[model samples]
Target chain A: MDKVVKVAVDAMGGDYAPAQTVKGALEALEERKDIKIILVGQEKAINAELNGIGYDKDRLAIVHAEDVITNDEAPVMAIRRKKNSSIVVAMNLVKSGEADAFVSAGSTGAVLVGGQLIVGRIKGIDRPPLAPLIPTGNGVSLLIDCGANVDARPSHLVQFAKMGSVYMENVLGIKNPRVAIVNIGAEEEKGNMLVKETFPLLKNCNDINFIGSIEAREIPGGGADVIVCEAFVGNVILKLYEGLGSTLIGKIKAGLMSTTKSKIGALLCKPALKETLKSFDASRYGGAPMLGLNGLVVKSHGNSSSNEIKNSIIQCITFTEQNINDKIRMHLEEE
Target chain B: MDKVVKVAVDAMGGDYAPAQTVKGALEALEERKDIKIILVGQEKAINAELNGIGYDKDRLAIVHAEDVITNDEAPVMAIRRKKNSSIVVAMNLVKSGEADAFVSAGSTGAVLVGGQLIVGRIKGIDRPPLAPLIPTGNGVSLLIDCGANVDARPSHLVQFAKMGSVYMENVLGIKNPRVAIVNIGAEEEKGNMLVKETFPLLKNCNDINFIGSIEAREIPGGGADVIVCEAFVGNVILKLYEGLGSTLIGKIKAGLMSTTKSKIGALLCKPALKETLKSFDASRYGGAPMLGLNGLVVKSHGNSSSNEIKNSIIQCITFTEQNINDKIRMHLEEE
Candidate 1:
């Protein structure tokens, strides 16, 4: 019998909650028999979506939660007040060791707050960063502290580089992953106060292979396997990356459909173009995992579809199995 | 006879110095007879590139500059010490009122420092920002303080909003241009300390059309005409925008060439695609202008070509003709 990697999923969160979340859970179960999902949300709503889906009843279970945390609500306040909310309940399951991981296609703030407050950070971990796997020209690179730690100090960024390295190496299977601090220029002396302070610290670190400064332009060319920065800079880069990718793709589509001659060209080129574009689709990689936590916490996009959720859940399996948190703790303790 | 706008050109600056700069000056004279260029660089090198170029010699003249500032040198120190360097000499023309503006495709740091230190800031201007006009979907938008004011305060961002508005409206002819402060999230409260502090101040001001917070994703889709942010965020977005644009274009070309059917499609679509792509080319928009200075100082890309140099020189004509600095001073004193 395969050992089950139990996942606690927030079913009442995200733009396409209950339906997409329930369907994604079912699909994940079908794809892998070595997993169990505890869906935490309104029982009636969840069962309505789950009805007639053929799967082992013992493997998939639903735990009823009375409330849903809306995106507009303050994350810390929501987590504190709404104890029975799906996100809070799901995180608690992971905290109690009832589940190995927690996945949510929900409010990023709520997930980040709940992950810290409920699931809790590992011992000696000062601050956990929300590290997302961004798609690059050659492959994916991990962008650490994308939205979590905005006012990060030099010490915090150093830890981000260390944690990000472990995740990229073990889970993503990049050997001796190249870690680079995000800066305005490639030169060590360039950048704002935070960057100038962090550069030498990162360069001097021996636990990871630290490349020098990486300007934002080099990011898409597969410049570094692990890109480290404070949350403010990281968030801007991540959002801009997504925005620019979609805008360009939209422009290309419009260009293809503009003329009759181009329409024929589009028809002939659709298959090849789709395959190439698929390679850059971020959802295929899964959700951003909040590192340095006692139990794994993953935050998916609010508008994620069934595939994204399934991929996110499956990603948790890899994270759990690889013992990423343990490695982070060990890496930190070596000082 | 049209009144000529005198622009001091840094002929020995940029990667294609002397050759492209001299050629571009001649081209600008050919395109616009109302502009006179004073080439500031080594006279021998400038004349060598200008030897065969046929133009009205009265509209083009060379003023010998003994040295050149390299990119690796510290900007402030270089500006003070290298008094006869091409960039410093060109800026001096603007400062002494011998030229209406100075244009350089040399080191960005040198250009920015020289613009402030030599040209000097307007009376009430706290800080002069390097505002670059970036290519967007429908048109171009001005990205203010891209690298100049990293530790910008709330007052600095407000001035950027005002200065950016004047540049977009008077220069780009954008009417009541929408101004937005770049933030991590679209919501009013979501962002780092700088954004949260600056948002409400912009909101209360009746001077410009202050659209609330804009996420980095909305920038490429022409979200706002005057996209305002502190230098660190602005720099990251600008570099990433250029990087991602090229990467996607490369991917699209690769996709079009993958198979025989797509190869024919590529041939059919090449003209239309090139025309569409040309609209988003950053060089066509000219160099970034250091706003709020006594005289205009435009910084073109280091890898600029003859066409970019021509466009940058021509852009100075508009800044001088429109009296942008006088308008900025007037706007500043009103408070």
Candidate 2:
């Protein structure tokens, strides 16, 4: 008999919660026979959505949670007070070994907080960073510490580089993922104090493939497989990437719609152009994982729809099956 | 007669050196009558280019400087050894009250070093930051500390906020420009140690309008007029802005040229589309100034052509005529 890769999803989280999350859960089950999903939310709401779609009952189960965590609520306060919230309950399932992985599209703060406080960090793990798969020209690159921990030390960044490389190689199926420190300049001596200190340390590490400094411009070109940085710089790069992509798309759409002649031209080029632009859509990459935790906790976008939710749940299956957390523990133990 | 703005141009610097620099100086002279230009470079090269273009001799003059500083040399070493270099000589003219401003398309490190060591800083200035005008939806916003100093402190960031605010108000015609600390999150408690320490200091300042915090995504939406941060973050933002813009344009061009149908569409939208995209071009914004210096020192792009050089020279006219340095001094003194 094959081992079951069970995932606990916060069905009442995210913008399209319950409907999209439940639909996504059903999609994941249909795609993978070896996977099981525990939908944590109000049982009535989740079951109604599941029944509306006529999902497979044998592969899907609902675990009731009384409350939902709103995006605006303070992370620590929400985790402390809302113990029975969908996010907390889902993480608790993972903690109790009832589920191998936890996925949430709820408030990022709450998700990150719960993943650490409830799911807990692996022993010897100094910091758990949020690593997101960012779309690139070649395929996708993992950007570690994309706004999980802000005030990271040089040591934390060093750990991020190692953990990020391990995840990319073992889970993403990349052979010897190249790690690079994001900096203002390509030269080793050219960044702020944190970068200057971290560069030598990253260069000294022998267990993983360590490339030199990477400028932010080279990121979209697939300059490195695993881009490492403190959360502040990583967050800026991620936000900037999304902002620029959206702004350009908006501009292109506006330009194409402006005049009668342009609109006619747009119609002719719509199919091919859409395909080209779709390659850069971040939603296709699903959620970002908070690495170095005892159990896998993936944080999806708050506005994620059914497709993104479905992709995220499927992503957790792969993460669990690959034993990413165990590898992270071994990597840390080696140090 | 209107007040004449005198701008000292470093014609012996940059990739094109005297040829493009001289042509640019002539173009600026023709466009604005209330402007006098001092072209400092090798006399023969300046004369050769100047002789090719017809302009009023009364508005333009050449100041001889024999030495040249290459980009690869250390900043301080280049500034010290090449005393007669165009950049150094032009900056000296500003220092001696013979010219109102100095402009160079030369090595950025050389210009920054010369701006501080030659032109000197305003009394009470903690550190002079390089501020550039970035194009946005609401026109343009000034991003301070683009490159002048690295490994900046919380105190330096505070001064940058004050100086950037002054420059925007007095020179850029922005009224009470809102100053925002570039951060990973909008909350005060967020960000690295530098931002945490700098946030309160900026808020306490009574002279400028202070906004709490701004994420990088909000920068292009006209979130704040003066975006203040250390060199590391500021440089990343500037580079990413340029990179993303260029990359998008490249992708669009590649897409349009790939097929016959798209080529036809591209031809139809050529004029209007070009006009729209040109507004976002970084080169059109002229040069970035090393702020808080006693005299104006503008650094143009390394690959700057004749038009960019011309625009930078004209930009210096306004920088000098506005007496921006005095305003910065007054703002600091009052605080």
Candidate 3:
């Protein structure tokens, strides 16, 4: 029998806690028999939600955590003080080698802080970036340092490129992903101080297949497999992309349904349009992995649904199976 | 008769130069009687293109500029060495009080440099931001400092907000425009060094209607009338918005044509969808104005069509009539 990949999930995290998290855990187990889940939250709440769902009892376990980290609390303080918090306890499972991965849909700051302080970093990793797979025209591109490490140096961007390349290759199964640094312009001379300093360094690195600078505009057209930037720029690009996508989609839908003639056309084109738009939905790719961490740490959205949670938990299986951390470590050492 | 808004246009600029520029000039003259265009470029090429179009010859004049600035040449060097370049000559017209505004589709760097160096900044104006009107769900929002000033300070951002608010209110007729600083998060303390420093300064400034910090994701939803940020962030947002808009539009069109059912639906809804999407087109809003300059200098896209150029030329009329520059000077002096 193949080894079961155990993923510790924070049941008390996210907006629809325990219920959605518990349901998502049960769904993930049913979908993959080789997956084991350790749901960490208030035992009674988790148990009440899990009672109706029938799943393999052997594969699911509950680790009672007394405290729950609220989104309003400061991240570092919460992580430091709340030792028995669901986020901290779930992270502990990964730190102690009790679980191969940890997934959370909680406060972003807390997840990022806990991932670094608890799971720790792999050797030679300066900063672990939160790399999310953003949907593009052709497929998906990994946007590294989406939120973590707002003040990243040139070397940190280089490491992000390497780690991003490894994740895209091993987990997403893309061969030799094209890596590009995000800049204001395509020219080498263009961009601010950080991009100007990092451009040549990325070009000189033999590890990454560095395609010169890429403008933010080319990002949506699937310009590169891995897009590297400092956290501030990356975060801006990610948020703008998300905001614009939803806004545009909403506008298009409204336009289509406004008139009787268009409404009839909309009904006929609904299936095809839905299929086309689905390709741009980011949640299908699961949560963003905090790359360069010693153990897998994934952060799902705060308002993640059952499907997103399930996808996030199942996503950890590939991280364990492919040994992404070890590959990242090897890549860093080689440089 | 109203005072003719004299505009010096670089006839030798852009991808489809002389022809597009001359045609655009003639079209602008045909559309508005109270506007005179001084086409600055190589006389032979300008006249050759002009001979084919019929317009009020009295309203259009030709100024011979011996040299043209190519996009490849270094901007500062090009401006200095190519003393008689079209961009420099046109800008000189503005400096000499012969023209109310100067419009160009040439090298952005040269235009920006020449605008500041030749036309000069208003007395208290710290920086002249290149503010462009970007399309959004509800309407359009002005994105200040899209490409001009990269290393902007908190004080510079304050000026951008003020100038952007003035432009939106006086030109676009938006009343008491809501100005917002672009940041990574909605919270007061959730940005990099620049945004952090700029946020409170903007909030405290009573000169403009300063709203709280706005995330990039909220930009496309028309969250603010004026989106203020440093040049790098603003440029990224602008380019990304344009790139993603075009990409999604292309994808939607392709999807609509793929299946027979969709094709039928697309045919039926083609007029409505086209009308809806056209409103979001950035070109309708005219060129990006280099705010805070003594004389209005606008940069149209390098690939601008005749329609865009015509719009850009007509746009100068409003600036001349409303006296945006003098209003900006007064606003800055108050602070």
lDDT of each: 0.89, 0.85, 0.90
| Better-scoring candidate (lDDT), 2 or 3 | 3
Q: Could you tell me every candidate's TM-score relative to the true structure?
A: 0.98, 0.92, 0.97
Task: List the DockQ of the predictions in order.
Answer: 0.77, 0.51, 0.78
Task: Compare candidates 2 and 3 on TM-score and give the better one.
Answer: 3
lDDT of 2 by residue, B1-335 (tens): 76898899889778888778888888888888889999998898888887756789898888999988877778799999988888889989999989988889888888988888999989888679989998776678899898878878888988888888888888878898999999877888777888989999989988889988998888877789999888877888888888777766777777777788888877776666676677778888898988899888888877678788889888876777778888888878875
Record all residue pairs in model 1 with backbone atoms less than 3 Å apart, i.e. clashing.
none
User: Residues A133-215, candidate 2, lDDT per residue (tens digit)?
Assistant: 99877688999999898878899999899899999999989999999998876666577888999999988999879989988
Candidate 2 C-alpha error for residue A130, in Å: 1.2
What fraction of the true interface does each of the listed models get right, in terms of native contacts kept? 0.69, 0.41, 0.75
For residues B175-227, what per-residue lDDT tens digits would candidate 1 score against the true structure? 99999999888889798888889999999889999988888888999999999
Interface RMSD of 2: 1.9
lDDT of 1 at B123: 86
- Please say which candidate is ahead in TM-score: 1 or 2: 1
Tens digit of per-residue lDDT, candidate 1, span A1-335: 65689998899888999899998898899888889999999999998997887888888989899999998999999999999999999998999999999999988999999988988888878889999999889989999989998878999999999999998889989999999998887777789998999999998899989988998989998899999999989988988888888887888888888888888888888888888888778889889999999889999888889999999999888888899998898888877
DockQ of 1: 0.77
